[model samples]
Target: MASPAAAAPSTRSVRLQIPRAHRGLRDGIEAWLEAERDQIVLWAPVAFGGGIAIWFLLPDARGWLSAMLSCVAVGLGGMATGTGGRLARILAIGGLLCAGGIALVWWRADRVAAPVLARPVVVAFTATVERVEPLAARDRVRLTLLPDAGAGLPRRVRVNLATGDAPVGAGEGARIGLRARLMPPPAAAVPGAHDFARVAWFAGIGATGRGFAPVTVIAPGAGQGGLRTRLTAHITSRLDGSRGGIAAALATGDEGAIASVDSEAMRRAGLAHLLSVSGLHITAVVAATMLLVLRLLALSPWLAIRLRLPLVAAAAGALAAIGYTLLTGSQVPTIRSCVASLLVLVALTMGREAMTLRLVAAGAMIVLLAWPEALVGASFQLSFAAIAAIVALHEHPAVQDWFAPREEGWGLRLVRGLGSLLLTGLVVEAALMPIAVYHFHKAGLYGAAANIVAIPLTTFVVMPLDAAALLFDTVGLGAPLWWLTDLALQILLGLAHLVANAPGASVALPSMPVAAFGTMVAGGLWLALWRTRVRWFGWLPLAVGASWAVLTPAPDLLVTGDGRHLAVRVDGGLALLRDRAGDYTRTMLAENGGIDGEPALLADQAAARCTPDACAVDVRAEGRAWRVLATRSGYPVAWRTLVAACRSADIVVSERRLPRGCIPRWLKLDAAMLRTTGGVAVTFAGGRVRTVRTPGDRHPWLVPATVMPFRVARFDGGREVRRRALQRRRD
Candidate 1:
């Protein structure tokens, strides 16, 4: 045998055996990290955003004392940042900022919330209409109402009014009086679903209900909102046809005018953003206005030569953004886009090249600080994700090469332009993929191709005609322009229908767990905010999150908030237990689990035997069974149903009170239990079942339900009561 020292492998030999790819990757990461050391500061804002998101998901603090503790944490974080090295100081500063952010949101929520009696209360209230949206049904208008003083309402409340005969348009301000039954905002439809109540609380809305009678217009022209309403009405009337609604939506941001079919089509085709007043529309308007102003001023050589043309154009662009914002009713997204544009214009005017990342960060910061609750909403998340991803990836060497311009003849140039559009669409779709799937549980398979075709048509033809139509109407010369707008809209709608109807146009995905979504967000942020090759580490969480989402199991049964509606998974489809075909929530849940079409159409998919008194689902495919029963409290058969359900069903759901004699061994959720849970989702696998509530104590927006007093105590002031007491004492 060889000597022991020679027989053992030398450490040098092991080092020499390392793979070339692994060594190269390690070296690249280190080099990138060293080169981009200073760019680490950009991550601070992302940390601040994390704080906002964390606070938003936290349940309402137990009391003011917890909020005060949050304040103390903020002060401590500030102190830590004061005594540290450069890296340590940066981390401390981010922590301090995060604590401060949490405190700010907590204080804002506490101050803004207005308590409402749980029971319905009828009141005659006078309020200003901050905004109005017409319902798809045409019979109602949803009004964002700001009550006059002493209305005993929050700063804002949404009320549904029956139009009766006075059609409500996009009027932003008109004082009106209404008799309405107001109740606390509705809770989440299912446990862990989006919490509308929390959203309403942060939005300053205390209550919501239908109007008891027709609204009275106390002051028709008192507020500035009527102008927008009139403009929208004029546009809709002039373009009157199938495409008129679409034209109005683009021109006035009155999306309610679009029919349900058209709306769904656009959404499925991934062209929904084009229908809204967003950054793209605002940017287009700004550029066109700037060019027009510059050309007009250049006609006078003295003005053009003496004045800074670029500065003047930037100022004009800012003004155009403001005008567009107002025209679109100053919705949150429109205002946010305006803010971003203004920031860029101001930077340009000051002779500075605005950094795209800085612009995005500033815009996001402003929006989040002003409306912290928006951090939890899908719109805010999706919009920011798109912008941030684009800014982060656009500078990659690979991306630069892909987007490089080429010199070509006219025909070749046309082909190149089309190819560029397709690439852009692909990039945007990729950026938005996670968010779209997490929120909507579906992604358009044909989205990239649809956008490639639709975007150019909308940007070049439809929007330009819409602008011309608006101008013509304003100046009393609109009929022809309106006709042209209508024609362009028809073409857009046809494209939407075609793409939406294509084979494999969209794919349904299972509901992503909250943890998986959060991990993906963190990964995306890590990649976007860092400039080091170390950023490649982000791929780890992203890959893991995607795998988790793909492997997550779907719930076996789902119940609605009121416990009146339910769905059971059978085969691969959901069997709806309710009578109606269009319960929006149920339909959404079904589609999320890859089920489509009406409940009646999917009847054969489930082995459900339902009678008037009870329904039983015998899932032969999975060898599982469940039963549900509903009864009026006074009916004797209600007791029978309960007893039968307790004895025979794997799960029992009772709409009325439980009977006195039944003790159920199976999972049983009653109306009383659902009142607290809001909704419930149950999953069954391998003879075991798990349940999750929709509402939880962890969400900051959720308001704990108050315990109602059993009885009212009062002092008696009646003369007969006093006399009877005195007489009884004397006797």
Candidate 2:
């Protein structure tokens, strides 16, 4: 190097030598970061939810203090928006939010901690009803009970009772006596099934049970039979059949009167949200109240001149929204709507943009701060997702032009409004598809069309008429109103039935992994939250997640928690390992296998060897024929026959343990092994096995068998107490 400066490449020259692809990538990333700079705060709720999810999975919060400290440090590091580059600032704020979430969830858990039922028990007790919820079943009703003070019972318990067995006059806040069979909330029967026990624990419900004997109304005192209960009763009394149930649900949010068939139809048509009294109902009530306020104020010239009409209307709307939220059971969705509505009202009052991503995020943050656990609930997730999507759509420049109001005649305006409704419905259904499938294992394909009709029918016609009926009932001028309400409700039901029964109306999907669900959600948020051209990149991950979900294979074999039931994949669906399974067991097996229809009985399936006590079937798994054997009668099998079958079969499943010589070629699953595992699902695609209870993964809800929270309690059938206790201890 004659001259060091000349020999070495100049810094500018080196920078210029960068590959085109690399430079393009860099430029793209910078643009993305720049676009997302302001949107960082919008992601705060997502980070917080991630922390809550971690707590649910691990349930270990020993390091929460450190997380909190980190949050403080991160906050300090990113105190100013321009403290660092956009990326660094975003990372710092995200870290703070994540840490805050962890701290909040840990603290909330400790605060709400209560003892859960450790075992089944029988007790006769008197309790007061805090609230009542109607079940889908005709004769059954769910009651939230408040146990007597100083009693050796939980502070709160949820129990079911046969309506026919209870006092006919029983309503909210009535003291009742009953002899019930109380049991711990149940765990999942399959590996990925819903965990009732976990839900119960978070909800502070110590036990769940059904009344084994008739319930007596100790004192029909109704300290809680307030307006909601009275309104529900009045609605039901005026309307009969399914109409009454729909009317009551729309008015008071209690769906007990709706028959199972009608409810199922609504679910299949994707109109179940209407009965849930969510944002749609809340907005309708608020908007109506505001319009009425404006007109009434206009009538009074003096008041109109003195008072700010819009401001007064907003205040009245807020009050109406709050009252409606309380009237309609105050479910998670209703509360979320109330929060969002309150935010919008505040914004309007302050002369700010009322509908924006910031408003949605603020509402979500409020809910999460109050009830962090709600983040995991379906209602919360769906509500926020829909609102965010709608707002984002409106924010789009192209969409804005399409939806922009123009000076036009009433006819043109009506057509434009209808077009907007239809388009919005389609967008919402598309956005909600993944979530709906994940939770229900099905998606309503024609939901958009069905909702376009159902929403208007319910919101514009049904609810208004029902309100009018209730208002005019005090003056005996409500019969026509009640009849009009019923007519609209019946039309809505008819639409539900029509849409649900159509061919391919809903598509059943395979059970998807949590990873896929998270991926879809991330992609959706990306597309909806960002305004830059890069937002379309969200589709890449969305497509990947959707493919993953649709391609997930069903388990090849399944065993119940108690090893009393077994199933194997068949040609069309699944074939039961035993024919003597009950309805509940059959339904669980079918659902776990991703089969919409009932499973074929092993006795009925072709090419199956069967007996009263055992059945042998040859099925294809992993592109190979594998013979499976299952015992049905729960009796000790003949050693010679069992050994012969074991030698020939690839898998052997029996209620009793096999002899030492009885070895299957692949696996032997017996009751002794299943007891520890809880339930087992085997997939031959990659020879994977999943269990309901993994070894060493114990929690307060899924306690180990060898370790009892108290004693290894069991129901001793009418045995003498002392003798039974002594026998139990000795055993």
TM-score of each: 0.84, 0.88
- The local lDDT score (0 to 100) that residue 11 gets in candidate 2 is 97
Q: Please give the CA lDDT of all the candidate structures.
A: 0.69, 0.79
Top-lDDT structure, candidate number? 2
TM-score (C-alpha) between model 2 and the true structure:
0.88
656-704: candidate 2 lDDT, tens digit per residue: 7768787889878887777678778888778788888776654545651
* Residue pairs with backbone overlap in model 2: none
Clashes of each: 12, 0
